[model samples]
Target: MAPKVTVLDYGAGNVRSAVRALEHVGAEVKLSRDPQDIREADGLLVPGVGAYAAVMDALKASGSLRHLGYRIAGGRATMGICVGHQVFFEAGVEHGVRTEGLGEWPGVVERLPAPVVPHMGWNTVQAPEGSRLFEGIEDERFYFVHSYGVLEWNFDVTQPAMRPPLVTWAEHGAPFIAAVENGSLSATQFHPEKSGDAGAALLKNWMGTF
Candidate 1:
C-alpha cells in the first residue's frame, strides 16, 4: 500500500495545494484537524503560510501542539512546509515578539536580511550531498514567499555519535536554511507544492522516504 500521508489543517496553511501535491506524488493524502490522526499517520505534513506568532497560535488552538512535538521527537516521519518549517525551531521573532515553536531542532526564525522584504518567487537551493529531500531535483528552483527564515544550523552534525541533518541553503541578500532532513523529521522553507516540476519531484522524494 502507498504511504498514508496526513496534511495537518490547523487553519494556517494552503492545505489544498499540499494535499494535491502529495496525491500527485502517488501517496495517499488525508486532510486532518484531529490530533489523533497525527498520532496514527504513516507520515505527517504540516503546511503553513503566515506570520510565525499567528501560525503558532493557531496550532496551539487546534490542540495538536503537544502531539506534534511528541511525534517528531519520537521519530514519526514528519515533514513541515514553509511556515510549517519555521515552527520546527525553538522560537521565532515576528514584529519584535518572540513566539515559542515546536522546537524539533535548535534554531530561531527571523526576518531575512534581503533588501526586499519578502523573498518571493522561484530560487535554486544548495542541497547537501546525499539529500533525500531534493533528491533528483537538487538544482531546480522552488517557489518561496516568505520574509522570515532560519539563518543557521547550530549543532555539529559531523560528530560520529550524532546523525546530522542534511541542511540545504538559498540566498537572497544572504544565505539562509532552505531545507533540512534529520532522521524522521524533514522540512522545507520553500513551498514545494507551488513550485512546478521541481516541487513534484521533491514531494515524490519525501513519500519515498516512508
Candidate 2:
C-alpha cells in the first residue's frame, strides 16, 4: 500500500514544499486542517514556521490538536518538522513568551546560544546509536534554519513513563537536539523537505515504517 501522509498547515508557511517532498518519497500526501482526516491519517505531519506561540495558537484553533494528541497516544505515526517539532516538547520560550507544547517529551524549546541567529544552512547531525530516522544515510547533511531548539533531553531514564526519546544532536555554537524518535512519534528540528537528497532518504525511511 502507498503511504498516506498528512501535512498540516497550522498557520505556518511553506507547506507545499513539504507536500512536494513527501510526494517525492512516494507517499500519498494531503494538506489538511480537518480533524477527521488528521485523526484517520496513516501518518500525521505537523509542519510549522514562525514563533512558537503563534504556531500553538493556530494549532489550537484548527481543532486538530486534540486529535493529533489522541492519534499519537494511540501509537499512530506522527512527524513534526521545525517549529512543529518544537511544539511537541513541554514548552517554548521565545522573546519572553512562554508557550505550552504538546508535552510528549521532556525538554524546553529555547533560543540557540550561537553567535549568529537563525543558524541556517546545511549541517551534519550526530545520529543516535540505532535510529530508524537516519537509517542508512548517517553521513549525509541536513538543512537547518532555526534559532531555537531543545538543548538537552531532560528525563529520568529510570522511569518507565518517561521513556527517553532516541535523540539526534547537532552543533551550532553548542550541541542541541536535532531529531527525536519516540515509538510512533518522530520529529526533526531541521527541514527534511528542504534538505535535498538526504532529506528525501529520511522521508523515505520514515514512510517505510508504515
Candidate 3:
C-alpha cells in the first residue's frame, strides 16, 4: 500500500500548496487538521507562514502538535517548512515576543538581526553528505522569505565546550542555519513549493523517504 502522507492544516499553514506539491511527487497526500488523520499518517509535513506564537497556540488548541511530535519520535518521517521549521525548536524570539515551541529540536529561534529582518529571495543551499531529504538535489537554490532561523546546539552533554554549537548552511548578510536534519525529523527555512524545479525535486526526495 502507498503510504498516506498527511499535510497538517492548523489554520496557520499553506496546506493547499503543500498538498499539491506532495501529490505532484506521486505520493498519497492528505490535508488534515484531525488528530486521527495525523496518527495514521506514514509521514507528516508541517507547512506554515505566520508568527511563532500564533502557530504554537493553534497547534496546542487543536492538540495536533503533541500528537505530531509523538508520531515523529516514533520513527515516522516528518518535514517542516519556513516558520513551520522554526516551531520545531525549543523556543522562538520573534518580534521581541518569546514563545515556547514543540521542543523537538534543541535550539532557540530568533529573527535574523540587523540590516536584514526578512531574508527574502533565492538563496543557495548546501546539502551536507548523507542528507536523504536532499537526495539528487545538488547545491541548488531555493526560495526563502523568512526572518527567523534555528541556532544549532551540541547534543552531547559531556562536550560542554562544544555544547550550544551552531551549524550554519548559508550565509546571507550573516551566517544562519537554513536547513536542519536530526534523525527522522528534518526542516527547511525555505519554501520548496515556490522554488521551481529544484524545489519540486527536493520535495519529491523528501516524500520518497516514506
Better of 1 and 2 by TM-score: 2
Query: Which of candidates 2 and 3 reaches a greater TM-score?
Result: 2
Candidates 1 and 3 compared by lDDT, better number: 1
Q: Relative to the true structure, how large is the alpha-carbon lDDT of every model? A: 0.89, 0.90, 0.78
Which candidate number has the best lDDT?
2
Model 1 error, position 208 (Å): 0.8
List candidate 2 stretches off by more than 4 Å.
161-163
The full ranking of all candidates by lDDT, starting with the best, is 2, 1, 3
The sequence of per-residue lDDT tens digits that candidate 3 reaches over residues 120-195 is 8998877677777677776788889887776455456675554232233766666677777776677888898888
Q: What lDDT tens digits, residue by residue, belong to model 1 across residues 1-210? A: 888988998997568988998898888988987778898888999999889989999998998888887887777989999999999889999889899988768789999998897999999999999998887787899999999999877976677888877899999888999999998899999998999899999888887787
Model 1 residue 72 lDDT? 77
Residue ranges of candidate 3 with Cα displaced over 4 Å: 157-168
Report how far off residue 153 is in candidate 2 (Å). 1.4
